[model samples]
Target chain A: MTRIAVDAMSGDHGAPVAVEAVMASLRAHPDLEIIVVGDADALNKEIARHRKADVGDRLTVQHAAEVVGMCESPARSLRQKKDSSMRVSINLVQQGSASACVSAGNTGALMATARFVLKTLAGIDRPAIVSPIPSRRGHTLMLDLGANAECTPEQLFQFAVMGAVLAEAVHSVDSPRVGLLNIGAEEMKGNVQIQQAGKLIGDSELNYIGFVEGDDIYIGDVDVVVCDGFVGNVALKTSEGLGKLIAQFLREEFSRNALTRTAALFAMPVLRAFRRRVDPRQYNGATFIGLQGTVIKSHGDADAVAFASAIDVARMEVEQQVPERIRTLLAHSLGE
Target chain B: MTRIAVDAMSGDHGAPVAVEAVMASLRAHPDLEIIVVGDADALNKEIARHRKADVGDRLTVQHAAEVVGMCESPARSLRQKKDSSMRVSINLVQQGSASACVSAGNTGALMATARFVLKTLAGIDRPAIVSPIPSRRGHTLMLDLGANAECTPEQLFQFAVMGAVLAEAVHSVDSPRVGLLNIGAEEMKGNVQIQQAGKLIGDSELNYIGFVEGDDIYIGDVDVVVCDGFVGNVALKTSEGLGKLIAQFLREEFSRNALTRTAALFAMPVLRAFRRRVDPRQYNGATFIGLQGTVIKSHGDADAVAFASAIDVARMEVEQQVPERIRTLLAHSLGE
Candidate 1:
């Protein structure tokens, strides 16, 4: 049976949401077992709300004494909160009690704790966050979303490899096209490190397309795009802001007069379909790749559906043996 | 009359679009006179298509023998193509024959030629591209869109000053709130240079706010957002990509079936208003601030209405004396 550990108290809505998500996830996947780590009292109380006969041995609770705040310092959380739900959940993976872990916690704290506990894969230097961004054709997998703020050329090359492997395993794309994100498409464009990284990637066995600009991410021609964490983070957040702004503008326009309101009722189904097709919730989980074990991060404010999606991502990575695949791929490509 | 120089051959659409834009701009503002600089044969033919009575001395042609291709090397264009239309237009600004210069050309060539001809203002180290991005409420002025790829902490500070001054002069806001764009809003979040730049901006007298994240740009709280050119360029281009993707998605949804098509008919007026409000063309002009003379960069693919908006931006900047304001603001703040 595949088992996963979840940080039940890390999200904005605490253990109740986690319990609800766990119950739903267990029903969806019969062979899956979930251990929700948090204050035992809170978790049990919420678990009691569900049908006890349905849960059986599939659902359980693990006690944790502390919780990490969303805005807490990563270093402080790692040093002080040894028994926190976020730390305990990752610990379950290290102990081999759980095949993978999912958390809706402070991202910095989670990354730091995961790296310290599970360590990097044999051929990898740093673990990078790889997530899929919805695009026109399908979706593009992008790496180093916010892990290494500043990266060496070699680190960027490493990210490209990990992204390609994950895309192959999860999305089932044969020989995914990997792209280095830059300001322009020209070979001479971008910062010095990016230029050097381009040469390295171009020399690799991975299907390396040349540099891609920011607009190319949504244009959806390339399959995987890699960049330093800072640029990726800004790009991701900027897209989120634009999405919100457009939604706000649409609402204002549709509510301007009674006639427009009538249009909204007629257009509701199409709009709903459009929203579902492009909903960020569908792309909720960000996998911390290159780690020795599987760990997925949900948005800190994720609802039950979004948290369940993160759990599903963790389950799939475990089934596909993503870390083992990454290790083997790196070994073959780099002769490490 | 405020005479402006137009590089009539620079844009993708070339001289015809420039002539059309100039005629419209002149009609909109009677006090404006424009010199269309390009090949005499082509420009005159296009200008002849307009009514001769409307062509009074306000619209005239200045022959420039050569035109710089969009893909031409900026350094090579500066060194070899001295008589290029883009170069000659900036030279007109330098020679005091034109109050401002506007071009929809290769951005690199425009910046290189404008800096070489006009020179940066006293006490300003680098000229930045400042443009307004539509936000939830109104818009935010962001600087260093792609001018300086790698910037020192001092250059970022300089960008904040320039952005604030432009916000005051063009948007007419008193003491604009200038924000340093970082990955996170915390005090110790970004890379070394960004952290150092945050300190410099925080110490300044110009209504300095703390660091703003990428989402803050469209949240419409801050007035001026300063960032390195690489980050700023990625953010701007990413927003553009998202906009196009959403438009494409909306088109697909509306054309899916007969019911959706009928819904689109009912939603047409509201959708049109929504598109108009967030249209990128309305915010086309990016002022090359910190230069000694006014130079506006329009999108290379701009249509007549968009190009006319760029000329209007140049006229407003000339009237408000943006460069002089930035120079004075910097001299007072930096004691340079």
Candidate 2:
């Protein structure tokens, strides 16, 4: 049984959403265990209000005094708020009481606290935030999603290895195809850093393809894409913005007049299928890779459904021993 | 009457598409004159096939013996192919025979030829590819779209002024809201370059917002977004790929079964509206800003209708004196 710790008070909806997600998750996975870290009083009320008589003792509550606000500085908040739920959740894993941790709070704070508590892997300089986005194939894992704004070429090479490990262990691909994100596909296109990173990745044992542009990320043919945090973050956010805009435009267009309204009835099924394909909740969890232990960060505005998905991701990460495999891959590839 | 030079031999479909676009554009704008540059034998044949009896002598043909392939190195191609259609179109603009030049050839070659033929404005160090993207507020103009891989804070500042000039002259916004694209919206979030750029923008006379993330580009609230060519190119290509992927998914979903297929009949209007809303053709022409003369770069795969759109863009750009306005704005803002 894998035990995962939850930051009960960190998400936009706070204890109620986390508590409901935990209940739903526990009822679904019989052998799964979870530690809910938050204010004991608030969490108990939520758990008591929701947990049924048939509920198991697999779900437990851990008390945390303070809460980290969504906008707080990662370093300042983690230092001042010693007993914040976000910190406590990472502490549970560091103490070996939980196999993995999930947080839907301030991303910067979570990364800072997780790195401070768990530290990076032996050979890894800094941990990368790897998130799965829906693509034409199944999903593509994009790394350095606002973790380190600037990275060295060697760091990008490390990201390729770490991303490959997760793709293999979690996604079960035989040999994942990794791509380096650049302005253009041509080898001579990007700056010195990307060219250097390309050489390092090519020399490695990983199945490194040449450079890929932004659109290649959604084509979904490749399994992993490596980029610096700055570019990765921009691409991710731009996609979200575009998706929202398209949805808004569709909504406005479908409601323009009576003829369109009638057409909307017939378009419902296909629209629903389209929704499922591009659903933001389905792509909620972002795995923080290169750390000693597993940490998954969910969208701050995630509802119970999305938070539950993040929990599922954490469970999968721990069950698959993704971090251990990454360590092994790094040792095998980089270490002489 | 404004005369525009067309690179007739450059696009995917070559002279046929260009000739058709010229006829269509002439029908749309009675006062526009075009000088089609390519092999005299091929262009005259195409013009004879499509040119109607009522067509005025406003249409003319120029002969060029050589052509630049799409993938050839920009410098090498420009250096070797002196009489190429791409080069001759810019030469017409340089010789003051045409007000603007439009090309659908290789982007690198186009930029190289345009830069070599028409040097940048006095205060500008490099020319930026400024293009309008469909957004909530009609459109948002993004600059440095693969023009310069790297940009200094000052160059970004100049892009702001140039983009603002286009927004005011071409987009017709009196006071355009300009934003600096960054990983995060926070004041201290981005790297040193962005931070310094933010400082310069905030201090400048232009209407500057603090910071905008990738998603904000599609939000349509801001008028102009400035970034280095590398990030801008990635964002632009990613949007294009996602747009295509979503369209493909919609096609597959709407035709999955008999029921969905039947619903497609009713949903046709809405889908068409969606298409019109996100039509890639409407956003084709990329204005080469900061140059001494006007130049428009159309997509290589542009169809007749899309090529006509590029023609319309050239007409608007030349009539509005976009380059002159950019030069004036630069001299006013930074020249002193």
Candidate 3:
């Protein structure tokens, strides 16, 4: 049975909603065990509201009296707030009581806690955040999405290798093609760091497809696109904002006339399918790879359904042993 | 009267389209004089086809023997192609033969040639590329769109001042608020360089607002957003791609059925207005600020209409003397 720790005190909605999500996910996956880490009284109160009894031996609660504020300094929180729900959830993964940890807390705090508790794998210097970005064709896995703002060429190479390995294991793409994010398709068009990273990636064993532009991200030209966190974050947020703006614009256009509204009724199915394909909640969790244990970061504003989906993602990561696959990939490269 | 130099051989369509655009723009503004920079023979052939003899006085053909290839290295071409159209056009700006220079050739070549020929203002260490970005409300200006990949804190400060100055001169916004682009709106969220730049901007006199996220780029939360070229380029291109994608999606949605087609005919006026407001060609040129003379880089695929619009933009910049205003602003800081 897969056991995962959920930071019940995290996210914009706080403990009650998180507790509701944990209970809902538990009801859906009967074989899965969930250890909710937060204030015991509040979590139990919410759990009792949804669940009649213990339901199974699968449910457990761990008490952490404190909570980390979203705006607090991550380093300070990691050092001082040892009993915070965020910290305790990561501790569960560190002690192997739970196979993975899921949180909707401050991203920096989660990264700091996971790094401090679980520690980086032997060959990885810095971990990266991987988020599946929805495209016209399907979802594309992008890495270093927001974990490391500054990176060396070696770090990017490791990110590409890890991302490729994860895609191979999770998405089942054999020989996944890796592309460097750049301003243009030409080989010599980016900054010094990208140029150096391109050379390193080209020399590596991974299937490197020279360079891909920002437009190629939505076009699904490659399986893995790698960049530093700053650029990656900008791309992710810009794409998200554009998606919402476009949806809003279309809705405004469709409602402009009665005839268009009538036509919208017929086109609703196709439009809904398109909206579902690009829904942010469907791809909410960002995987923090390279740590000894799995940690998935849900969006701060994630609703109960989205948070439950994140828990499901954490369970899948634990069951698939993605960290081990990444470790093995790193080991092979080191041996080479 | 504003006399601008147009690189007839710069864009994809070359001389004929460029000349036609100049002719069209001249018809709108009869007082405008255009120096068509290219081979005299080819330009004469295109102009003769138009059958306008007296138009010669308003439009002068400046002879240049060579042209810079789009894929050519900027540094290499600057050294080798001294008599190229790109170089001659910039030389006109430097010599005051033309008030400003406009080109749709290689961006790097245009920047390099402009910098080499006109030189940066006394206080400016590096030049920046500034473009008007479409926003939900209207439009906002973003700086360092692609000029320099790496920028120091002081360079960022100067960029803010330059960007603000341009916005005031061109967009006519008094005391345009400047914002540093960061992953989060918090003070300490971005990389070390951005944090340092934040400190500098906060202390500067240029209506410095705090940090902004990528979502604010489209929401028009700040008048001027500053970032290094690496991040700025990703943001710009991602927005461009999304704009195109959204337009395509809307067209598909509106033409899905016969009823919607009838609605589209009535809503056509409003939709056209919206499209015109956000059209990429409407904001086609990017100015290379901090140079001694104004130089505008039009899109490589810019048609005759877009190229003519770029000339109008160049004329405005020259008429306003943007470089002089920037010099005045920087002199107090740099004592130039």
Candidate 4:
């Protein structure tokens, strides 16, 4: 059985969403075991409310006295929230009781706690966030989403390595094509940092495919796109903004009058299919790569379905032994 | 009459597209005079083909012997292509024969040459590229699209001032709300540069609204969004890529089967309205702000209608006297 620890109380919706997601994930993954860490009484009540009392070993609750606020500072959370649910869940992973941990808590707190607890793997300076964004092909893995806002050229090279390993392990692609994200595709296009990183990556054994522009992120010519956390974060959030704007525009046009409303009804099926194809919830979980243990961060506002998808991602990472694979790849490629 | 010089060569489609756009703009605006600069014979042939021989002095052709290649290096273009159509068009603006100039040529070359020829306004470190992006409320003007890869705090502040001035002038808003683009909205969220830039903008006479994340760019909460050219460029190109991906997905869904094809037929009008609402062509032009003279850069692949939209932007900037207003604003705000 693949054992996973769930931080049951840190997200915007709190324990109920986490408990419901746990129930749904348990039902979906027959060989899965989940330990919900939070206020024991509230979690038990939630489990009872869901009528999941019959599950014996597959579902269990571990008491955690506190919860981390969604907006709390990472440093303060690390110092003050030692017994917090987010920390306890990660503790479960460090203690070998769980193969992985999933949290939709404060992102900064999660990264800090995960790094402090598991520590980065040998030769890894800092843990980087790697997440998949929808593209023309299946999807492309983009790294350093918001962790390590500023990075050295060597750090960018490390991110490239980690992203490539995760893409290969999760997607089962051999020698995945990696790309360095920049303002322009030409080598002479970006700033000094990007230009220098390009040289390091070019010298590596990975399947480096030169540089890629912002549009190339979705054009799906490369499987793993790498950049500093600052650029990646802005790019990701900008995409979110654009998606919302397009949806709002479509809503306005479809509701302009009775005739357009009728057209919307006729187009309902096609619209639904299109929405399903680009649904952000399906791509909810982002991994904290370079850490010694597997940690997946879900969207803080995730509902049961979205949280369940995150659990699915944690399960896959656990089965693939993502951290171990990354360590091995780093050693082999970087001769660490 | 506002006489504008149009670079009749240098775009992906070259003279034909520029000539057609000139004809369209002449028909749209009677008070507008356009000098098409390129190989005289080719431009004349295009004008004759459009049956616009009787445009009189409203539309004229200026002979230029050279055209800058779209992919040519900016430095090479500046050093070698002195008599290129792009340079000649800008020369017309500098010589007081044209109120402004528009080109769908190489962006780097355009910025380099325009800066070299027109020079930055007093108290401005670098010129920024500002363009309108669709937002919930009409649109938001964003700056530093790709002009300077790295920007100092002062440069960012200048971009904010310029963007605010353009928003007020072009959009007819008073004291437009300005924002510094950052990874997080919090004061302490971004890198050192952004953190310092926030302080600079907050202290300025302009209406600074604190830091905004990428989503706010399209949320329309702020009138002007400012960032370094690299980040801004990535955000803009990423939006373009996402737009294309969403359109491709929609097309696939609508062509899935006979039932969906019939649905698309029924929904054609609504779909067209939505497409038109978010169409990039309507927002085709980006201004080179902070320069002494007004210059507009259109997309290289722009069609006749899109090019005409760029011409409309040029006309608006000419009427608004954007560069002169920026100069006055900077003088007052920065005490230069």
CA deviation > 4 Å runs, candidate 2: A53-55, A185-190, B185-190
Tell me each candidate's RMSD, in Å, in order. Answer: 1.5, 1.5, 3.0, 1.6
Candidate 3 residue pairs that clash = none
List, residue by residue over A1-336, the lDDT tens digit for candidate 4: 999999999989989899999998998788999999999999989898886754567998999999999889888989998999999999999999999999999888999899999999887898988899999988999988888788899899899989988888888878999999887612244478888998988888899998888999999999999998888989999999999999988888999999999999999999999999999999999999998889999899999999999999999999998888878887888765
TM-score value, chain A, candidate 4 = 0.97
DockQ, candidate 4, vs. native dimer? 0.67
TM-score of 2: 0.98
How accurate locally, in lDDT, is each candidate?
0.90, 0.89, 0.83, 0.90
Tens-place lDDT per residue, model 3, B47-111, is 88885654558889999999999989888879999999999999998899988888989988888
- C-alpha lDDT of residue B76 in model 1: 87
Regions more than 4 Å wrong, model 3: A27-30, A51-55, A185-191, A247-271, B48-56, B185-190, B247-274, B334-336
Residue pairs in collision within model 1: none
What tens digits encode model 1's per-residue C-alpha lDDT throughout B1-336? 789999999979999888899999988888989999999999999989987566478987899999999888888899999998999999999999998999998988899899899999887788888899999878999988988888899999999998898889989888899998877612234488988988888887889888888899999899999998888888999899999999999999999999999999999999999999988889998999889899999999999989999999999999888888887888888755
Residues B125-145 of candidate 2: C-alpha lDDT, one tens digit per residue: 989999998888788999988
Error of 3 at B313 (Å): 1.5
Give the true-structure RMSD of model 2.
1.5
- Quick one: ranking by lDDT, best first? 4, 1, 2, 3
Query: How would you encode candidate 4's per-residue C-alpha lDDT over B217-260 as one tens digit per residue?
Result: 99999999999998899999999999999999999999999999
Better of 1 and 2 by lDDT: 1
Residue B230, model 2: lDDT of: 87
Best first by DockQ, ranked: 2, 4, 1, 3
Candidate 3 lDDT over A240-311, as tens digits, reads 766666666667766777866775665566566556545678787889999999999989999988898889
